[model samples]
Every structure is written in C-alpha cells, then in structure tokens.
Target: MTPITEVEGRRLALSNLDKVLYPATGTTKGEVLHYYAATAAGALLAHLRNRPVSFLRYPDGPDGQRFFTKNPPPGTPSWVRTTAVPHHEDKQARQVVVQDLASLMWAANLVVEFHTPQWQADAPGIADRMVFDLDPGAPATVVECCAVALWLRERLAADGLLAYGKTSGSKGLHLLVPLEPTPADRVSAYAKGLAVEAEQELAELVVRRMTRALRPGKVFVDFSQNAAAKTTATPYTLRARPEPTVSAPVTWAEIDECRAPGKLVFLAGDMGARLKRYGDLLGPLIDPDRAGRLPSAR
Candidate 1:
C-alpha cells in the first residue's frame, strides 16, 4: 500500500489496524478504544469532508511523541496501528473511511471526520449517515447536537426522508437518512439545500448561516463541503498538530448530559457492554436502505 505519513518511533502495520486504532481516537488498549472512537467521530467526518481518502497517523493523546501513516510503510511509528476502517464503502476502500485521517478539526473544539471522492459508494449500498456539524464558537454538547438533530429530522421527515441518529463519538449527533434512488451528489445537494432551508427557517435562532458571520460564536450549517470530490476526515485520524491527537467517538445520549473534553464514554471501561448494549447509532447511516442515496455515482 502507499504510505500515508511518517513520524518518530511509530511503525505502521497494516495488519493490526482494527485491533489497535479506531476512527477518531488514536491507538489505545482494546478496553478504551470505543470511547475514543465515538469522541473522534465528528472530527473524522469533518476532516474527510476537507481532504481526500488517505490514511493518517500520529502519536497518542493530548501530547503524543510521534506520528503514524496509513500505507505498507517505509517508516511509521512503532505504536501506530494500521487496522483502520474507512468511513464509507468504495471502489478503493469504504466511501467514508472513519479511522485515523486528520490532525484535528480546524475548529476550536470539534472531532471531525473525513470524506472521500465517492462520498457515496458505487456498487453495493449503505445507509445515508450524516453529521450535522454546528459551529458553536462557544462550548457545545449533546443537547445542542440533538436539538439540531431533532430539528433536522423534523425537517427531513417532512420531505419524506426517514432518518436515524447517533453520536459522532465527539461533539455532534450524526443524523442519518434513508433516501431511495437519490444519487450521492443529490444527497449532497439536498443536504446543502436543507442547511440553507434550516438557516432561512431558523434565521432568528442561527447567529449566522453563511461562512461570513459574527466572529467566534456564530453557528453555521456546513453543507458546502458535501461534494464527493470533497472529503471529510474519518474518525481515528491523527491530528497534524504537535501532540498526536485523534477525535474521540461519543454517544448521542451522552452528549446532552455530559460535557467533558475527552471525558470518555467508550473505552471508559467496558467494551462488550457498550458494543452489545450500546450499539453504534450510526448503523443506519451506512445502510443502503437508509443512508444509501440512489445509483448516482460518477
């Protein structure tokens, strides 16, 4: 495979990716992986939206010592885990490779994800999982994400779109939808339209809608970055910053009640408990029935 990046001390291993690294959060013990995965989901999504499909690698934590890569490797961090998962299904890989992809979101406090050229896969199919990224210059939580999700769901359902919800493993709730026959581009256009519609409807509530808005605290609905050519960072991707950090996956239910920066939901302690009992809400997102847009791949 092609090398993603290189860093000190880290050796990229394509085999153990699944066992070691996750979407947003970086390498960790099997016990605490999910929490990081959830926390970093949003960041992963955002990152993908910005960049192309490439494996990202970095050290661990608020201050990691080295970086990692996503290829067969000339040299990568020894601690780097290569068993990463793509965000979506695709001709090359999954459409949305949700694992290690970016440094950190450009935003102050957001766990973004990555998007690939084929935002929607070509062959088979999956659900239309989406992340409603809200720019709350100030601090934000699950409540805000859910409130937005509810509004979006209501708005979407009105248009005959049935959607589901989940935590981005971080700051926002990803509201997935089930679209029939709509192409990925159409989905992107639809989402953008929805964002514009939301902005218009909630003009009073939204501090700003367009990228141009009040500095620092304006909440904007990012729909412009929905094109398949445009990519969002998948979860577990490393941040380009000095310290090796990845977005941690979070839960929608936990978002409203909890507001701890890296407080932890998955990898908090139990894996089976969370996986078995706390299923990933984004499941429907990749479902062809729900997240799948019509056969519109280029």
Candidate 2:
C-alpha cells in the first residue's frame, strides 16, 4: 500500500517508499523523493524551470523493469503543470514541467531515477545550448574522457565559448556550452564541426565516428544529442545503476584529478554539500546576456 502526503498544499500518493531502488547501496524510494524535494529550491530546480522533462522510471527498483515516460501519467494532478511538445514528428505530447517542489516530489513517487530534459526551454525546436556527450568505450576509462574534456574546454575557450562539464552518472562525461537560442539544425552543425575538429587534433584518443566497431577503447564525441527532442540527463539526477550515483556538475580541476572510475562518484546524499561548494557553476550558462551566439565552427 501507498501513503499520501501533502506537499505545497497538494496531495501526493507515494508508493513503495521502502523498496530498495539501488540494490548495492540499499537506497530506498523515500530517500530519492527526499533528495529532490530538498534540492528543489537550489541547483536542481533552477535548471529544471520551464523545461519539459522526461523521466526514466523503475517500477520494481533499479534492478527490475524500467520505462521512459515523457507524458504525465493518467490521473496526474491538475496542479502538476505540463507543456505540449512534439514527439515522433506526427503529433504533440504533454511533458511535465517541474515548476514547484510538489511536482518534483510527485515524480519521485513514481520511482524516477533519471531526469532527461530537452535542450530547449520555453521555445521548442530552438536550442539554448550545445552539448557534446563524451562516451568512453569499454576498456577506455573516465580518465581518458577527462583529458579529452580538458582539451575541448581549451578549444572552446579559445573560440570565446564557455564550456561546462558534468559526469553522466553512468559511464561518461558531458560537456555543454550555452548558445543564443539557435535553430536546432544550426546547433547540430556547430556541434558536429567542433567534434570533427577535436577528432582531428586527438585522432587516437577521440573518435567522431559513431560506429561501434571503431569505438573500442576510444572516447566517442557524440554531437548528435543536440537535435530537437533529444534529451540529456539533468544535473543532480540519480542514475539507475547498481549504485545510486548522481549526474554531478564538477570543476575542471576535479576532472583533472579523476584518475580512475568510482573516484568521482557522487551519491544522492552528497548533493546538498556539493551545492554548498559549487553554487551552480552552470548557472551563468542560462543567463541571456552571458550566453553568446555560436561562432562559425568552420
């Protein structure tokens, strides 16, 4: 049976609160909900505001069945706001917008372990940021990705674009640069160009090719995530891995020190303290005046 709780004057039905979502750590659904509600007023909610979010829900815990849910489930509270966004090019789907703490808590009740939000907010089909998902192939470690990320940072800085980095919370790192809301096509082109340049500079360490056969032991610079409707895990969201790891924002110095796997792992409980230290290093990316237009990647 589930228990009902009132959050922000709205009733929320929480189920399986005691169920262990992370088998290795024995983390419970209750802890997950508490983390979101606790972080809602700070770094987490600031990035989520007005963005259409897709949840990766694990109904039977992280080890069991999971599904990607974009639309709010049937019987969602009227107070839980949603925005109509295009899906599959045929029609529109209503995606939840985490506008308040209550809504954040509501999603946690559904056992959502991963928060994947579209790149664009408020303006659909237009992207406000360009992201490069640096995925390291097996036998290749996070250390290799860190080196490439540092290189990418230098390259972007030379071009006058600011880049921010965060762990993917699963097995890789993501580097993002804010851009003046440009057409998704243009954003994709700019990202691909940058990826190609990186590949040329570090031919052995980075691979622009997406073919699996060629990716072994190389860091894949995935520029394709810049497309419209494509989503990346939101910062501070927990991954449904064997352990309850979080997609944590990090400093360049920290990335340089990340010599091995599990060294940079951030659990849900560590988020508050991270907020205290980092104070949202990515916040300036969202500032209208701070984000600049993409320079020709040619």
Candidate 3:
C-alpha cells in the first residue's frame, strides 16, 4: 500500500495500511481507509460536515489499547479544516471537522474506528438534531431497544415531528429527531422530558434513570447524550467490535426487519451496497426547513 494517498490534491500520509484491524474478519487498515474514502461523497461526509468529531483511535488495532482524541495530534495537516468549539462558559477547545476526503482518510490512518460528533457545532450554536440514545441493558436485547425506538417514533410523530432510527453499531439503537435551529439547553431539556414521558407510558420497557444497576432487563432512554460537548457515533461509522460492524441508518420499515438478530449488522464492506439501496434515510435531518419543535414540558 502507498505511504501517501493523494485525496483531492491533499497528500495525506497513510501508514500500516496492510495491518489487520478487525481480527475476526481479517479487515485490514487499508480496507477501513478505503471504506470511509469511498463513502465520503454519500452518507458519511454529509452527516459529518461542520460537526466537531471525537475520534475513537485504536492505533494498535481493536484488541490493543484505545483512547478518545478530540484535538488534532502532532501531524494533523493545515488543510484539514477545524473550529474551536466552546467547551464551557470560560473555556473553548479546538476540534477536527471533516470537510474533505483527505481529512477523513487522515483519521482513518490513525485507526479511528469510530466517529462521534457533538450535536451542536461552534460555528453554529444552534443544535442540528435532538438524540435519544436507547441503550438496552443486560438480558435486554437490541430487539427490545427497537420496540422502544418505535414507540418513541410514534410519539414524536404525534407531536408533528419526524424521528429517524438507526443501529448504534454497538449494543443498542439510537433515535435521532432533527430540529430546526434551537437552543442546545432547550433541546436537552426537551429530550429529557420526552424520555420521561416514554418511561411513564411504557414502564415495563423503558427506564430514564442513569443508574446502571437499575437498568437491567430494560432499555434506558438516555437523554443526557443531547447536552453540549456530548457526542454520538456518526451515521456510517465503523465501530470497534469483534465483528466489523457499522452505525447504519435505516427506514421505519427496516426497523422491524432489524429485530431479527444480526439482520441490521452492517459491515464496513457492505456500506456501498446499502447506500445504493437506501440512499441515506437520515438525509432529511440536514434540511433546515424540517418543521419540528419540542412542546413545553408537562
């Protein structure tokens, strides 16, 4: 494999391309780099544009030590666009924003298996979407989380909002509801209220508590992920798991199909085919004109 990949006139250094990352599938670092590069013009880049990314870098592969990287490391190129997002009222932090294929490939070279982005960006304080992270605890399967996601989708629809569902590419599902430009605080509060309501109606299936001990046998409606600086896996990201699975966007009809175990487990190589079929179900979220707002908390 070449040491430097010329992506759109940018000579990004790509090392150890032949090294295997996913031991189970024998997926090489080169394959991972190509996966993001090939998908850049479609779902991956569209969703990641302008968002500050927190990369889950696994330099020694998935089995080795791993850590989160927000700031650009020693060799980040000047051409890679970035912005200083507000971390707190008194402090700000610079974050990588992948606007081009070279930036995406550069991250891939670092073995950034997962891409997590803040809901709101520094250039725009207004939130892009409100997320309800549906995490299924022990004894509870992704199937249960799917049920809860469908329920949330129904309620959001009742309130004149459209909610999109996707596999977290991990152990659960994530329901993302796109919002017009709104205050981040208000978005967080609204998501919390929505989760509380879901828990109230479906007491058996949903739990809003953050306590891990109390989460057993139930899907936790994690509203806390909507806050500023908090990040969720970007759609089409490759997750670090035994199987080289990806965070995949799905349609309402496909959600039911996902209930079957492993049906929605999208692998890195399977991305292009899926994109050809679905064409980005979450694309509507980027539309600024989508009419959706949180009703006052009850």
Candidate 4:
C-alpha cells in the first residue's frame, strides 16, 4: 500500500518513495519530498505562492526522458488552485498555482522541477520582477558569470533596481531585479536594454544574442526570460541534474568571492545549514519595500 500522510489537513497518498530520482547520487523520491516538506513552509512557498507553475517532470530520473507540462497533470486534486491563462489568439490554458505546503508536496511527489514566470497568477499581464539568466557556454563557467554579475549589479543599481543572485542549479547564474509591478512589455524592454549595454561594455565576456556560435567562451545575458510567456526555474527548487543540485540563492559577497564553479554549486543536502546561516538571500525580492521602478525606456 502507498504511504499516506496529512499536510496541513490535506491527506496525500505518496507513491514510490524509495524510487531513485538522481541516479548519480542515488537520491530518492522520498528525499526530494522531504526536502520540499522541510523548506516549502518558509522562503520556498513565498516565491511560489499564487504563481502559475510549469513542471519539468522526470519520473525515471535524470537519465530517462522527461517532459514539460503547463497544465496540472491528470488526477489533480479538487482543492489544488488553478487559473486560466490567456494563450495566443483567444485560447486559454488552465495551469496549477501552488499556494501552500500540501500543493507543493503533491507536485513534488510527481518528481517535478518547479518553474514560474515573472508575474503571479492574479496579475499575469504585469511583471513584478526582471530576470537575467547568465548562461556560460562551455569553457566558461559560473566563475565567469561572477564578473558579469558584478557588472550587471552596478548597472541595475544605476537605474535604482536592487539585484539578487542565485545559481541556475545547472551551469549558470540568475540575477533578478524586483519591480514595482510594471507592464511585462515595459520590463522586457528595460531588461533588453541592459543586456545590450552589458554586451557593449563587456564585449569579450558578454553576448546578448541567442546565437549558439556566439556563446562559446562567453556568458549569455538571457534577458528574454523576462518575457511574459517564458518561465524560469524557481529559487530553492531541485534541478533534474545527475545530482540533487538546487537553484539556491546567494549573497553578493558569495558572488564576489566565488573563484571556482564548485564554490557556487549547492546541493540539496546543503540547504538546511545554508538557510540557518544566511536565511533567504533572495528575501529582498519578496519585500515590497525593496521593489523599484524600471527607468523610462531609452
């Protein structure tokens, strides 16, 4: 019989608890659920609450085929909150909005990597944050991203935005700037302008374009993720890598001191201690007082 447990009054039947989800590290499904159960009540939930999430499900571990789903998977519970999002040409897509622990665990049980757009479910047309995905092409790594991040930090600060940094849980860094609920197109335009400026100022280290050949030996400032339709890997979510690496938030001090790729690489096991030590490095993103307005488009 599958084990059943209650989370905040919701009874959930969890299956395949012992199934290995990260083959390289032998991390199990139960461990993943435990991590979410432990962290979701805190900063994790704050980031996900009321946001329409897209799931990258890996039922058979990292080595097996995986798929992305915007719609809540079949058999979704009646209590799970959902919102209809407008798609192209008058079409609508109903998507899951994780608002609490039970909802989080239910999704975690499916072995998913949580992703969310820049805006929340209640205000899909408006963006409350701007994001830049610093992807390092091969031969370049997070260490290289550090320099670019520092540059972008100063650039954003000049425009009155305070930037927060986090690992991509893959091979890159993500920088986010909280906004005072601006239109998505306006936010995208501002982000694009900064990306262009980064490329021009740090030409050797940065590339704003998505062209594959232009990326090698440089960091790609992926401002496109700020667009309304795109989603980013949520902070504190486990990535479907060979190991249970988390997309963990980091302090600017940590970013400045990072001299190697491994320095920024954080696994699921490190979360508890790190949380105890640093609290939420990205907490400013959620603080309404910290939100800033984007400068007028040039």
All candidates: TM-score? 0.54, 0.95, 0.94, 0.98
Q: Candidate 1 lDDT, tens digit per residue, 1-298?
A: 4223322332322222233333344444332333333444343344343223443333233343333233323432333233333444433432123234232211111221222433333322221344455544444444444555567767876666665554444444344454554445666766777787776776644433454545233345665444544434444443443223333344545554454534433333343354456454444444555543333233
**lDDT tens string, model 3, 189-271?**
88888889999999999899989988999999998777776788888888888777888887777777565657767788777
Q: Alpha carbon lDDT of residue 219, candidate 1? A: 49
Arrange candidates, best lDDT first: 4, 2, 3, 1
Q: lDDT tens digits, residues 11-55, model 2?
A: 888888887888798888888788887763567777788888888
- Extract clashing residue pairs from model 2: none
What's the lDDT for all of these models?
0.42, 0.83, 0.80, 0.92
lDDT of 4 at 250: 95
Model 4 stretches astray by more than 4 angstroms: none
Q: Show the lowest summed lDDT stretch of 10 residues, model 4.
A: 85-94
Off by over 4 Å in 2: 87-89, 114-118
- Tell me each candidate's RMSD, in Å, in order: 10.0, 1.7, 1.9, 1.0
Model 1 ranges with Cα > 4 A deviation: 1-53, 60-131, 139-142, 207-218, 233-271, 291-298
- TM-score between candidate 4 and the true structure: 0.98
Q: Which candidate's TM-score is highest?
A: 4
RMSD of 3: 1.9
What TM-score does candidate 2 reach?
Answer: 0.95
Question: Per-residue lDDT for 203 in model 4?
Answer: 94
